[model samples]
Target: MRFTAPVDGEPVGAAITAEPLEDHFGAHSALESALMAAFDNGRNPIRSVCAESIDQNGGKGVVLHSGLFRVDGMEPDRGITA
Candidate 1:
């Protein structure tokens, strides 16, 4: 898959590539399984399975998009607690 960032940031509009490999597929599959389990526990999957596929590739999926867009217009200052 080909990934491109917008022109506003450093290395903007750069095309990122995900090499089709077993490792990537495995990571994606594992993430999907975890997501399904989370759903079973009454939690919603954070992203779709295909998006997760992009994640395991190299774009890191929706995270890159979220940081760039900031739908609520807020920066994540605290970072990840864990």
Candidate 2:
């Protein structure tokens, strides 16, 4: 049987990936950056970086739906807080 995305609008079987392993650390990092941008510029950014992966049998799955982002465009200001 073929797999499909549980969410609507998005293409079916669309998976997401990052430069590093799709672990908690990487996923969370993606989200943090987004929030920081929202606070810094005061405009909630529209992060559209949904990612996921599969295993050998393509059964095991891991989905990444916008977490603490660690990407560019949102230079976090650790010196200050929102």
Candidate 3:
């Protein structure tokens, strides 16, 4: 996943899975900074941003919540298998 700040045209967040044993460091902080840049610290603040998570009970979900994101609802069979 990649997040960019349109106001300054800068990349704010990125996640790369290069190796199975590689740990995800600074992901939460990066995402939190991205959200803050998009929603809080700009002249043209975005009203909302939508994100989807495959595992709602996992680390991604926890990071989202830390950025004040809430679960709107779930869509059944929304993944590629559907």
Please tell me which predicted candidate would have the highest lDDT against the true structure. 2
RMSD (CA, angstroms), candidate 3: 13.3
lDDT of 1 by residue, 1-82 (tens): 2234332243322221122111222223335454334334321121233234343456433333322223232323224356
Question: Which model, 1 or 3, shows the larger lDDT?
Answer: 1
- Could you tell me which 10 consecutive residues in candidate 3 have the lowest summed lDDT? 16-25
* TM-score, structure 2 vs. true: 0.19
User: What's model 1's lDDT at 12?
Assistant: 22
**TM-scores, in order shown?**
0.20, 0.19, 0.18
- Residue-level lDDT tens digits of model 3 in 5-82: 322343334222212011212223445454344333321211122223323333132122223222234321233272
Off by over 4 Å in 3: 1-7, 14-62, 70-82
CA lDDT scores, all candidates in order: 0.30, 0.33, 0.28
lDDT of 3: 0.28
Ranking by TM-score: 1, 2, 3
- Once fitted onto the true fold, the runs of candidate 1 whose alpha carbons sit more than 4 angstroms away are 9-11, 17-78
